[model samples]
Target: MAFFLILFVLLLLLPDAYVWLSFVRGTSVLWSVLWWLPSGLALAALGAAAAGWFGNGLVRIFFFVLLCVAVPKLLFTVFSLLGRGIGTFVHGAAAAGHVAGIVVAVAACGAFLYGSLYGWKRLVVRQTDIVAADLPEAFDGYRIVQFSDLHVGTFGRDDRFVRALVERIVAAEPDMIVFTGDLVNASAAELDPHLRSLSRLRAPDGVYSVIGNHDYCEYGPHGSPDGAELDFEEVKRRQRELGWDVLLNESRTIRRGTDSLVLLGVENVSRPPFPSRGDLRKAMSGVGAGAFTILLSHDPSHWRREVLPETNVRLTLSGHTHAMQFRLGGFSPCGWVYSEWEGLYREGDRMLFVSSGAGGTAPFRLGAWPRIEVLTLRRGTR
Candidate 1:
């Protein structure tokens, strides 16, 4: 926590200094004060949060305020640097650059506001078709609705969003519903308010889910390891109450007529800095080698790290990336961290689908809008 706080402070200072030197230093006293006042307050909030003086709710508010203040400053700094570099070679370039920076900062402020107010609530549905030679003939044209990274704490007690989401999924009339994970941001209590709304979700086959990194209760204030464990159990119990089959490193077989397919779900798994509790071997123990299988693992990294090299799981579903909740022209900084960040990725006969996520810890989404995925399984080569 201390390391991250220091890093965030450094990030804020760099842009704050750049913008002051380039634009506010020589401006009116009013302009300078206006610039430094919010920056000071943001830093103070950061210190309070790091010192544990604020509660979870206050910390979240501080984070949102920090983003509002920092993002525009960062944008202005980038444009200001470009302008200064150009000013060395061209006349009036620096002045024009300053104007551009201001314009960009204003636009960023508007975008952040809009993203917070409307973008996160604007749920979009994406449809994908998966064709595999190994798919069961009876399961052809099976429509599965996949939603992930719900982060229910973002909604507080409001069931409106979940109700709307459930309505949308029900209207689609999918054969099955699969949730990739991150059902809550930290604790099981977050799921309480939306239990009724979420329970409305139904499918002919069943609703299946697997845990995500956040479901472990380690990211938030759980008091102790025992408390975290209890909270985790409560999360699973609530999901089961909602009629969801919470698969924890387990497999289930779905039979249609004489044809059958395997559905394997594992606990959260990821490379370092994140937890890796999934045991793919254990999940597949009783399954036949040739059975067409769909694996639900929270992190997309698990698909390449274990599934591809070790198992014949034909299709993998995941939702941990969230595209950092920001994207432009099909690109995001999340790509720098996750090789298969969003959308469908295929390697030979195996495939993985990563959702941009239906909800998140922060109530914001830019070009990477919250989404629900409708995938159709077809029994043929594409």
Candidate 2:
């Protein structure tokens, strides 16, 4: 909290400071000073909200506005400084600096606007093939459709988008389907509206799911711990009603002819600070050593902190980061936060696939765009 306060204070002052510098450098004093007002006011509101002077709703509103103003201002300030430095060094003229600064600032604003307006809605399908030497021939060519982090509360009246996503998943005709975790943001009621669209998801091998940290009501604003437990139970019940096999620290087996594959699921597990309720050993109890195994766990960190060193699970699926709902080109901020943030990561014979997630708690997204992942399992050599 203290760190954030320090960072916020710096951001709040930087833009206004840059504006003042611009005026001193012969820009119109009135226009330059006026430009700082929006950024200044937004930063003040954000700081007040962070200090708990305002309510959470107001905090969210102020934050949204702050991002809009602050991002462009920061980009302009940095680029302007660089432009001025280069122009003064090469041409010895301040006008050249001003022109470069203006062009860069305009481009930055245009990029941010485009990302906020359209990138969140640009949906795509990501496909990959995995070859496992231990996989049974009957299970070969098996396709699994994986999606995670559908913070349903954020999709208010976006039912058509939800329906379209489901339609696309079904059209791909996966043999099995898996929802890694995070079906809703905070409350069980959030999933109520999207049930129909979600129910459309179907597969020959059925859909299996595990609870995400958010699904347990850990982030709910209105609930006490006990009330949150009830909400958590309701989430599981609703998932079951949708024909999903909700696994809570348990394992099940799928048979094909004489061979079988182990399907294990552990509750959300992460290092401390994030809840670590999953019990991998308990879930894997009584499982055969020779069979191919796939585990469904919510947070990708579990694969590194627990699964890799403790078990021989061949594949694990997870989604908790949501890639911070922002990315550029193919890189995400999530990479800096987690070792195995997104996409397929392999180590020897084992692999982990982290979905960028299909739905986010926020309506804004950039290059990270939501996706549906289709993974096909093939039985062959490495």
Candidate 3:
């Protein structure tokens, strides 16, 4: 809320000085009649509450019935006037030192609001018609949509944000949805507010999930401890309540006509930042080479080191890095955390797609948006 108050003050005050200095600056008698400052102060309170500084989440959002009304061109007045002096030399830029201060302050505040209030939801659209020869003739052109790393806690939560996300998932219309893991932040309480919205996730094969690094929340060495608020057992129990098939080193088959694709899933044990107790061989021990295979392990590095060369999984899907949870154009999040942070990379004929992730670790997301993936698995003849 302090963040929002500072923002409103900058927007409202800077432009006011400019507008008043101009002829539009009403005379003392004329301006005194309006009560403008009081109105602006009231609006600031609303902004603070909406930002969750002054009230509970429901009081802030997801319970609002009021339509967002248009704001007055409050800041534009000062900026429009200042725009004239910007091209000239910095010294003569403004007659008043306060005007210069206002310009700097306003610019900084606007940038801060956009930066802190926004989040990325990575919607992975997987296209797997890559190996035409490998796909069976009967099941060519199939798409499997998978999204991992929905860290539903302090930094990456808001009803407004998730409500908008639900709309995007519906738009994708995936053939099937696989949640690779780390669905909640740390505890069941963290997910409590957003359960109804997340439950709306739909797919024909259903929403399957695996546990990731943060789910345990220090219940194990692999769990997250950096400002975590929930425990491991509570997280596991809540996941079952939310309709996710928690796959712990297990395999299942999704049959199309007479052909079946072996879908293998495991916990976060085999990934970096965790022990290698995950037995990929055991997960796929009985599966035949003749069957189409899709492995849902939580780390992409698993494929590069162990899964691809050591084993023969055709395609592997994983997500632990939210793409550094920050990326812009040529810049990727890999440098900050995981070597295999985002997008598709291949080793030999095997392919892996690591999603940036759906939720964030904090409330602030500068570059990356939240995610909902629609992976299209087009089976081609290998």
Quick one: best lDDT, which candidate?
1
Q: State model 2's lDDT.
A: 0.81
Report the lDDT tens digits of candidate 2 across residue range 1-382. Answer: 6797779778866866785776544667777667767666666766575564543344444545555666666766776676667776777545655666567667766765665566667788999898888889999988999988887777765586788889989999998899999988778888877898888788988999998988987665553548878998999999998999999999989888888898999998987677778999999999988868999999999998888998999999999988887888778878888988888899999999999998776666677888899999999986
Ranking by TM-score: 1, 2, 3
Q: In lDDT terms, how accurate is model 3? A: 0.62
Candidate number achieving the greatest TM-score relative to the actual structure: 1
> Which sections of candidate 2 miss by over 4 Å?
20-67, 84-94, 223-225
Question: What are the RMSDs of all candidates, in order?
Answer: 2.3, 3.2, 9.7
Q: Residue by residue across 194-222, what tens digits does model 3's lDDT show?
A: 77787787777766777777676642222
The segments of candidate 3 whose C-alpha lies over 4 angstroms from its true place after superposition are: 1-113, 121-132, 155-157, 219-231, 270-277, 380-382
Q: TM-score for candidate 3, please give it.
A: 0.64
What value of lDDT does candidate 1 attain over all alpha carbons?
Answer: 0.88
Candidate 1: Cα lDDT at 91: 91
State, as a TM-score between 0 and 1, how close model 2 is to the true structure.
Answer: 0.88
Candidate 1 error regions (>4 Å):
1-7, 21-34, 48-56
